[model samples]
Structure formats: structure tokens, C-alpha cells
Target: MNLYPINAGNFKLDGGAMFGVVPKSLWQRTNPADANNMIDIAARCLLIEYGNRLILIDTGMGDKQSDKFFGYYYLWGNDTIDKSLKKYGFHRHDITDVFMTHLHFDHCGGSIQWNKDRTGYEPAFKNARFWSNKDHWKWATQPNKREKASFLKENILPMEESGQLNFTGLPELDVLKNSALGFDIFFANGHTDKQMIPMINYNGKTICFMADLLPTAGHLPIPFVMGYDTRPLLTLDEKEKFLQMAVNNNYYLFLEHDAHNEIITVKNTEKGVRLQEVFNCNEVFNLI
Candidate 1:
């Protein structure tokens, strides 16, 4: 199997929101914020090439939102999913599967796009099957007060309307093997209900797509949960278990939102799990 890091786009989010109650003075050591108190965020999606299938892990926030909507995120950089795919001799239409970690706008927004005349929204990848768990599909469609804004209707629904939406079978425990996307999924709910973390076996290493579970290396600490999480306390427990497993199994964490560090490993330190080392896609998987 081959893997590539597809940078859909880059933007900034409030540091406090990203790091939760963690003081700026502390988080700034790793994730330095701008004067606006915003930290760099990457809509870093992963592309998997297996057999004849070209599976895109998640599409970044698509370019369908209005200018005013994008102004809030402070988007930067010239990267787009099409450009990133083309860099590796692929295109958006080549994607056969789109496995979203969750239904958040930033994660799945790129899955849908505006039609030619801008009359209605449609699936961005016409030939791909969109994958999200049944539970998350419901939660996102019937969003709660806390996540209503993050789960935009335009970013979703279109997949189902496109008649390409498929629900992966939920695992009774921590891991769901042989998912529709052909990878094990680690189910996490602290950030959102049934957030699927893809665990891909690549080049003799377990590469875990760390969605919001550990957005960046700075989030290695257990208490550094995001303020956006619906259940911060639940996140604490989930992180404790997942981090311990990562250390024990030596999983290569593929960070989706960390702008600085692309891939990293965690080791058990005196203080708890901490960043072991940072690696490039070339050094780790020889993506090029």
C-alpha cells in the first residue's frame, strides 16, 4: 500500500479553542499563536493507494462557502486537494472512496461542491463512495446546540443525495477492522460522537490518522483537550487509553490538523505520553 499526505488547505483557529483551558503561555511553547490569538491549522487529508482503489481519507474545507464564511477561519496558503493530488500524479476524480473522520465542516466540507450553475450542492468526487458511521451520520444531521455550527448542512447531506453514502459497521470495542475503506478504524467520541480514526497498515508500520483526537504534537498531554469537544472529560479518558496504546504499539500518528508537524510518534515519558519524534512523509513512507 502507498500513502500520500494531501494538503487540502491551511487556516488558523483560535489558540484557546484549539488548546482548551490550557494557558496561551504554555501552549505557545509548541504552537505559537499570532497577535490575533490564532494558531496555524492544516486541513491535512490523507490519500491511500491500495490495489486499484484511490481512497481519500478526508477532504479539507471545500471552496463552496461564501467569502464571509472563509474570513472567519483566516485561510492561508495556496494548497488545494486537486493540486496536492496532481502533485503525486492523481486527481480529485481518481478518488474511489472518501472516508471522513467525522462530519465537521473542516473535515468533510470538501466532499461536496456547488454545481456548475451554482443552483445546488453536489458531491465533489463523482466516482467515490462517501463513508461515515451510522451514528455520526445521525448526530451530524441532527446536531446538538454545541455542534450545530460546526456541522453545516451544505457540507453534508449532498453525499447521501448523491446516492454514494455508505455506513461502516461499528465496532463493539475500540477498533473496527476491515472497514469499508479497507482499514481499521479507531472510534473516538470525546471530540464528537463516533469520530472514526483510520488505522492504516503501511510499509510495516501502523499509521493512525489522528483527526481531532490528537490534533498536533502539542496535544500529546492528556489534559490538552480542545474546547470544541462536546465531552472534555470523556476526551481525557479516551486520550489516556489511546496514548498508552500508541506508545505500547509504536503507532505512527498521521496528524490531520497540525500545521508544523506532519507525522510523529509518542513515547511514555515521566509526565505521560510525549512526542517521540517528528518525521516527514518521505522519511516515514517514501511518499514521493
Candidate 2:
């Protein structure tokens, strides 16, 4: 199997929100904020090439949202989903599966696009089955007041309408969970309800799509939880446990939001679990 780092683009998010209660004095050293207090974030996605299947993990914020809506995030970058796919000699139609980590706009917006005449929404990957959990599908469709803003209907609703929506819901052990996509789903609830983190076993190593669990290397510290999470304390517990397992197993974390650091390893430090090393995706690929 071959994996490609797809650059869906970049955007800005509030530094304080990204770092939660962590003091600016600490996080700013790694991820500096702009005058508006926004830090650059990459909408990185993963492209998996296996036999007769090309699975894409998460679609970055699409260009369908209104200018006013997008202005809030301050989107910027030279790379795009289309350009990245072309780099690997493929197109949207070539994608057989779109494994969404969650229904957040930045992660799944590019799955759908504006229809002809720009009057309605349509599936961007016409032939791809958009994969999301049944529980997350329900939660996002009936979003809460807190997360309502992030669950844009335009980014969703199109997959089911296109008849390409599927689920890997709460799989039972000993079963080939994501046999369709060729990965095991690690469900975590601290970030959002039943958010699926794909654990891809490639060339004797496990490359975990970190999603929002460990947004960046800077967020390796247990206390660096995102303020947007509904349960911050739950996140702390999850991070502590996950980080320990990652450190012990030498799993390569594929960061989704970090602009600079793409992949990192964890190590046990005197303070706690800390980032052991930082490297680009190719560095891990070379190890493979």
C-alpha cells in the first residue's frame, strides 16, 4: 500500500481556543499567533492507495461556504485538494472511499461542493462512498447549540443525498472493522462523540491519523486540550492514555491541523509525556 499526504489547504484558528486553558506564554513559543490572535493550521488529509481502492481520510474546508462565513477562519494556502490529488495522478472520481474522521466543516467540507448553477449542494467525490459513524452522523445532523456552528449542513446532507454514505459503526472485536477501507477504527469520545481515528498498518509500522485528539506536536502535553471540546477533563484522560500507548509502540502520529509539524513521536519525560521527535511524512515513509 502507498500513502500520500494530501494538502487540502490551510486556515487560521484562534490560538487560545486551540490551546485551551494552556497559557499563551507556553503555546506561543511553538505556534505563534498573528495580530488577530489566529494561528495558521493545515487542513491536511491522507490519501491511501491500495488494491482497487483509493481511500481519502477527511476533506478539508471546501470553497462552497460564503465569504462572510470563511472570513471567520481566515483561510489561506497555495495547495488545494484537487492539486494534491493530481500530484499523485488521480482525481476525485478515482477515490473509492472518503473516511471522514468527523463531520466538522474543516474536516468534511470538501466532500461536498456546489451544484450546477451554484443553487444546491453535490458530492465532490461522485463515485466515492463517504464514510462516517452512525452515531456521529446522528450527532452532527442534530447538532447541539455549542457545536452547531461547526456542523454546516452544506458540508453534510449531500452524501446521503448522493446515495454514497456508509458507516463503520461500533464494530465488534475480532471483526475486520474497516475492511472496506483497510484500517482499524479507534473510537474516541473526548473530542466529539465516537470520532473515528483510522489506524493504518503499513510496512511494519502503524500510522495513526491523529485528528483532533493530538492536534499538533505542541499539544502533546496532557493539559493542552482544545477549548472547543465538550469535555476537557475527558480529553486529558484520553490523551494521557493514548500518548502512553503511542510512546510504547512507536506509532507515527499524522497530524491534521499542525502547519509545520506533520508527524511526531512521544516520549516519557520528567514533566510527563512529551514530543520525542518531529519529522515530515516522508521521513516515516522512508522508514517504511
TM-score of each: 0.99, 0.96
Candidate 2 displacement at residue 280 in angstroms = 1.0
Q: Which candidate is the best by lDDT?
A: 1
What TM-score number comes out for model 1?
A: 0.99
Runs in model 2 with CA error above 4 Å?
171-179, 286-288
Model 2, 80-194: lDDT tens digits are: 9999999879999999999999999999999999988988989999989999978899999999998998899888898998899998858663123655577887777788877
CA RMSD of all predictions: 0.7, 1.9
In Å, residue 264's CA in model 2 sits off its true spot by 0.8
> In candidate 1, which residue pairs clash?
none
The whole-model lDDT of each prediction reads 0.93, 0.89
Alpha-carbon lDDT of model 2: 0.89
